[model samples]
Target: MNATTVSRLTSFAPAAISVLAIEGPRTLEFISKCWQPNQGSSVLPTNRIRFGFTKATDNQPRFGCNESIVVCRTNHERVELHCHGGKQASEKILETLSSLGAMVIPWNQEPCLLARDPIEQEAMEDLVHANSIRSTAILLDQMRGALSRELKRIEQLNANGKLQEAVDCILQLRQRFAIGKHLIHPWSVVLAGPPNVGKSSLLNRMLGYDRAIVHEQAGTTRDSLMERTSFDGWPIDLTDGAGVRLASEASDPIEIAGIDLTLQKAREADCVLLMVDPFSGWTNSHDRIYQETQGKRILVRSKADLQKATSVPPSLLFDAQVETSVMTGEGILELQSAIVAALVPEAPDSGIAIPFRTRHIELLNRLIGL
Candidate 1:
């Protein structure tokens, strides 16, 4: 209760403003020494942002720069300093706290308990660095005790010997956690195929904009391009990788390198969209590249408007297949839905309770075993 811990809680990526968290029972005392509130009193009220300026540990204005800072007091034990995100402002804040004997650390190095309970702290920690709005919403729900409340209920159910209900709860948590685990890191989906099969076009169509360059030139894409977007409230990292082709057809060493990199991306991607020109029918390269992708794959007949074949042959052995046209926008929404379903088979509703960390689930599983 007496030990004060200070940490820079916001991202350090050269933003317009930054935030620093000062926590512990002695937080107000240390803050009073360095931060002078505009009202001329250093005592902060709970849940209110007090305007302030940075001062030295000896209670003197460090400089005449007259910095405008908004300080939020969550409680007597917790204070958040919102200041200009520039390097100089952050340095002054950290220097002042360190000079006062307060433990200054990075956000990640802050102590585990951020709030009164574990889930609230975990969600707050994530919210500070959330990249997308969808991720922020999901974490905000967790902060409302959605996951913690659910876990406690399951624990009681298990203790009451309701084995079936407990099992169902555990299974649900485990399933939903897959999506929760990717709050920061988007789920990766790779667009892969032979050159000029409309992989780039499909990517553009999905994004509803010209994010990927579309052209008739083979091997136009010499490297992977990534785009970030949310599908059905789930964040996705759509990667447009270079098209894989046979050595005879793709002899350019640069394109060959790109193709090799594409293969590796497909192997690691959460879902692979194997696009083929339906007019061209099934090619040997199609099967060869399919074999290279290790996990979930969707065979897509691209340029569906130019179909010249009777139908997709069963011998092609596609696990799942869809026809899409970038020009006419045929099957684009359906393909997007298919991709979402493939990556997250079961979609979680907003505010659904799902563990965001491995330890949270592990502890629940341990309880089930007990």
Candidate 2:
């Protein structure tokens, strides 16, 4: 008898539902041992989802329990169990399956056993971690053979002695990698500026809810607060760093540490919003912070409602600048647009082949010599 294998297919975090996959020559027999269909025989037909309750075998009466579940038979050898999300219901089902001679394996391993190619395997693995609707669609396309088809076309081009065409195709695909890489791992944008510059307010405003503490005090935020947010379906991490103050001005050790961390994160961030309250105007400390995030920084004029209209400082507006007022709800949309433009100037059109994994990039690099 072939060994039956079972694995949980979704994240363990509590949700409305969870899925488990069972596959092997004896999968149906093993499932029938524990599954008690609500309205029909325990024997499940192929390709039909049946409602049921799972229970431990009579021999193992000590662990007896019933969990409401729905099972889908993909084939004679494969079935899926959908149950309430969390550890309890799924754990009971797994325990019952294990008792019935099914081998439990890691969820990641299931893809390797079923996928036709490495690309499909990677796509299947990453699709589970996609955070946004757009990301899910892109990964679904890849899993459905978008990248595989493109690679086959490239191979055909190279074999036909069209070397230049193949090279150009690879170059074009590489360009999309910038966006592809961020599909699973979001781009990081840091909010860095001097104390009392409205960094916290801007963070709360952009997130559409209050995440960081907003106070009038200079050092209200002494630590970093990171939140995941999306703009136009692009995933991004916005980190609100502590209010950077001059070392001499900051007397407390904890405040000094926070300032140091802000500068460090600013240096490492993909983009930094260096803010300046127009009421206080730009100072020497602002210039120093700007130097830390020189290339990947945007100049933001905050508290715009409190100040009279004035031209943006030409020297400070290196990347781009937006005037914002949290109280009046002004310039927030424009700021989001600026950020999207800075990070992703152009999103990939639908159905485009995007190299998303390290292995895909390495293979493309090797093909350049061909």
Candidate 3:
């Protein structure tokens, strides 16, 4: 073999001779008959290593298909076999071992084995289910005791009786956890506005695809449609809800109900994008609807291309506003950046630790009160 291959083979050789305890009434007879190793090594008295050929009950050779395994008897009553990794080959070996009265047990179930720490276990689960590179990194760090180490430090400081300092540190970390939790699990952003205001159009722009129906008809979207999209590494649950409107003579009961449901969803959302046509400005109806949404709200001026001016008017004052045109894909990038800036800011140097679970938040709150 080449140098590299020899080095790799040598590295794996020690681990290859794993000791598997075979105990039963037929253990000694089976080991004496089937145990054969290709290499010639003297078998020690009580602690012996024998190179051997394995065969089926029919006396057909099974060693040709499988690599020759090492059978070692380290005790008077039991034998150990080091076998290959294929499932069928392992199964056949195991069946042979069992027929010789060996009791099979998984390595993980062995007593006196060190159990994995909770954080390590959680990390394994996170790695298995992680959907993004950033999330996986965060989870791996957490599994490596990043959060647990911090908690332990906090506990130590508190034990020294620096209660106020400990409290302050935990409180700051909790704030970070809030943002981190959202980063790991995106919050819901709902678009709610009167019909024909380009809500659906904006939805298509945000998702970079036509997921919702966009038409001139006022009540075209009578039900909410949801799409998952990410903005600057932060996952977002973007929902295009049925347009809200004052109950009119022509409005059917179903349409009215849809509007009410849309309003309710807006009230419960993490952020509400109240879309309006810039050319039309904010109408009295828009003002009334805006007053009803309880969550974080931002005014989005749609159809900016049709507007005579590009700037926000002096009379219109809001926390934030974005001018966008879904038709030409203008200001979409700016809108996405603004959304990320507003919702998920960069983590501070002190490190923000947001709870990944409701249980964590609840426990934190209890600890805070104490």
Candidate 4:
């Protein structure tokens, strides 16, 4: 309990600032060795942020000692260091602290010391991985005890002999868990179709840039290229998979492997954008691919600009169809909307309690069973 502990509270990636927490009996002794305040005393003022630059100690080298930093003594045994977010600055500082007998721990391990409960700790951990603003908002609510308050309400109802009411509340939370589960794990949307179709073009258009290789040649994309993007505030991993064709037509082994990989990604994706054009109209191969995916699908009629007064096929049954021309940027927004609607048909209201973790869902299921 008396040993000093040092942990980085921010992500390891480069940012505007990185936070490091030093706690335990030796916190002040370690802070004094590295940080030199601009004014007043080297002694850190309790709860006040002091501007300083880390200086080299007798035992440590001066490699990253000159970086500007700010320190705040949070409590009797806790001090927060705000330093440059670049890897070198933080790493050197942590190295200095570790060399001075401070225990260096992972950022994730620091949450348990600060969070009041497991739910809040999980929320804090998930916040670092949140890809979209919407997901961050939900995790922020959870961190602020939104889920904890709901659980308490359920407990209160059950204690008062309102068993049915408590069960109903747990059921609602369980239903909301569907959205919570996707907060950290972005939805996977795979673009799949035959060669010469505009699958890659549509993926590039949706990404607002050229990420996948778009070519006139068939099978230009020999492998799956995945790019992460946000549509309507929901994080989506859009995969431009290799063109799926019959084994007899695909002569190369690489293409066959890519085709197999495409089917695998399709099977795992939250939704598959089945692209087809007038030249390569929906065929038996496309049907087989769709059947293999066994998931939500949206038919994309690509290269509409080339379809000059072409007749539409009536036999194709699909959950939804969007006619798009990447050249004209047509139907792109509609496609994005369709994808979001397909993945998240009903979004939970703001401040609603959501079970973001697997344990939360399990607990809710157990409560409902009771």
Q: Across residues 130-233, which tens digit of lDDT does each residue of candidate 2 receive?
A: 98877887888888788988999999999999999999999988888888898899888899888889999999999999999999988899988899999878
Please give, for residues 1-370, the per-residue lDDT of candidate 4 as tens digits: 6578899988777699999998888989988888888878887769998999888887786743488989999988899999998988888899999999999998777634565777877898899889898899999899888998999999899889999999988988888887899898989999998988888888888999888888899989988889988999988899987899988888899999999999999999889988878887777668778789867889888888886433435675666888899999889999999998888889778887889999998887777664
TM-score of 4: 0.92
Given candidate 4, what's the lDDT at residue 269? 88
What's model 2's overall lDDT? Answer: 0.84
The lDDT for every candidate, in the order shown, is 0.80, 0.84, 0.64, 0.86
Name model 1 segments beyond 4 Å from true.
13-17, 25-29, 37-49, 55-64, 108-115, 128-134, 208-211, 247-252, 307-310, 315-320
Cα-based lDDT at residue 76, candidate 2: 73
Q: Could you say which candidate leads in lDDT?
A: 4
**Candidates in descending TM-score order:** 2, 4, 1, 3
| Backbone N/Cα/C clashes per model | 1, 0, 10, 0
10 residues in a row with least lDDT, candidate 2: 309-318
lDDT per residue for candidate 1 within 173-250, as digits (tens), equals 888878788887788989988888888888888888998777888777889999998787678889997878877887
Q: Which scores better on lDDT, 2 or 4?
A: 4
- Candidate 3, which ten residues in sequence have the lowest lDDT sum? 2-11
Which window of ten consecutive residues has the lowest lDDT sum in model 1?
56-65
TM-score of model number 1: 0.83
lDDT tens digits by residue: candidate 3, 1-370? 1110000011123343334555444556655545655656434356776766565443434534545676666566556666654444456665665555455565432221215655445554445445554556666666666666777777788789988888887787677675657545667788877778889989998897889888987778888878877776566888887777766522688878878878877887778887887544556556656777766667787888885553433564454678889878888888787776667566443322334555555555666674
Candidate order, lDDT descending: 4, 2, 1, 3
